[model samples]
Target: MTSLPEDPSPMLNEADRDTAVQRLQQAYAEGHIPHEDLDERLHQILTARTRADLVSPLASFPEEEDAGTAFTIAAAGGRIKRQGAWRVPRTLKVESAYARVHLDLSRAVIEHPVIDIELQLGTGKAKITAPRDAIVDFEDLHTGWKDTLYKPPRRSVSGGPTIRISGTMGYGRLKIRHARR
Candidate 1:
């Protein structure tokens, strides 16, 4: 079964942080927190490395939820593409059979710093186009005839989402590349 990352930080996307910020602003407007405290909390929320870091600041506010949740795509002898301003989930499961899977995250909303992509491909191709600053990890991928057109990051990166791609492929190909600026 495909699963979430060991740490849930990757699940807290920019929208989540923005929600927390709005909550903080609301609290400040209502005099729930002092100006100094609000400023400090906002800083923390902006630089939060993990979801837990946003909890304390947003403790008094109700959690802002997104129903989009985990994004799942399945293609059976068809093609699938993800692009534009769609919300990114902590976990993404993609299954393709004699089809093509295209994931473009250049302008997509990213929730987690370490996004996990579970791919189940068969006689197909999975192509992912990510931001230039983003990193692609395929160490756990189990496939046949793998081809990557871009230079993979050497190590885990900060400030941008790191896509961790993994899964089974039968006579399929996987490609990870940076989006054209």
Candidate 2:
């Protein structure tokens, strides 16, 4: 006899199953997932009776539309980082004081054509790595006791979204760069 999981997943309805199947098919068509993964996830989703059983199969897929959180990442003298394969919301606000923050969007899932990032930092360091084709605009960003100077070697391509960063940073360091494709 075997024991059950601590938290059993709730059973899935027909609509939920249909949505999952459609997401898998769309991901496959967009080349987000390989052929093997598409086949495996389709099988898993078909056989999955509960929502929790679909976790592993849909792990590599991006979240559905409006699935990203809308809350700001607030920190006080702490470290905050958003790296690797993560979802990036359209509008993001980061507030911190004496904290170290790093945001790497090299392998992120961006679902918008324009992204707005408002950073309010005080006495700390922040590093943002955007996609190579992304256009970063910080002209309206103000700094006290230090200036935010950003000069890219080359112009941004007409591919990725335009990232607009505006806020006030006091005596802190801000580094922004475009990651290679």
Candidate 3:
């Protein structure tokens, strides 16, 4: 990991670099990095040559220790539901087969502005109920199921966490819904 000078005027281009810089800024705002270190990292990000170069500067950023709170529900042939008030981690992985899984994030205590949901299902139903203000991104999810109730966001939205849904839905139904409030 090569170091760079702290100069705001450093040259930058690629979109990935921009996103990395924004993540660093978010971490700094969360007090994960001090002012001096952030400035140095920001400079490195600005002048980074490859994606791997940008990654090194962010390696020191603190990861959420609350990942243990992430809800991982695997049902072979039953109903699995995560409702009521719960802690929403930075990543939520769900694996289901011949079962029904429901994730209720309306009353969840979200600790980040971005959440990743990895879904792997087979011949079952998986439903995610989140707050109406949430920005659900399921563009990368490909399901062989014909009756999916997911409605991909038509436009960009903010003011809430961006729920990124990925992985395979298998021969199951996946739905992205909102809480009734």
Please give the RMSD to the true structure for each candidate, in Å.
11.1, 7.7, 8.9
Q: List the candidates' TM-scores in order.
A: 0.61, 0.60, 0.59
The sequence of per-residue lDDT tens digits that candidate 2 reaches over residues 103-176 is: 98879988777788888999888888988888889877888866665656375477777888888889887889
Estimate the TM-score for candidate 1.
0.61
Which residues of candidate 3, in runs, are more than 4 Å off? 1-71, 151-157
- Using lDDT as the measure, name the better of candidate 2 and candidate 3: 2
**Colliding residue pairs in candidate 2:** none
> What is the Å distance of residue 48 in model 2 from its true position?
33
The sequence of per-residue lDDT tens digits that candidate 3 reaches over residues 40-87 is 899888888766577677887665354446667676878878888788
Which rank order by lDDT, best down to worst?
A: 2, 3, 1
Q: Tell me, by lDDT, which candidate is best.
A: 2
For candidate 3, what is the total of clashing residue pairs?
0
lDDT of each residue in 1-181, candidate 1, tens digit only: 1211235565577767776677788667656688878878888899887787877776764344343566688878788888999887888998877888889998998755678888888887778888777877888888777654455554544567788888888886777877655
Off by over 4 Å in 1: 1-69, 147-149, 153-158
* Residue 51 lDDT, candidate 3, scale 0-100: 61
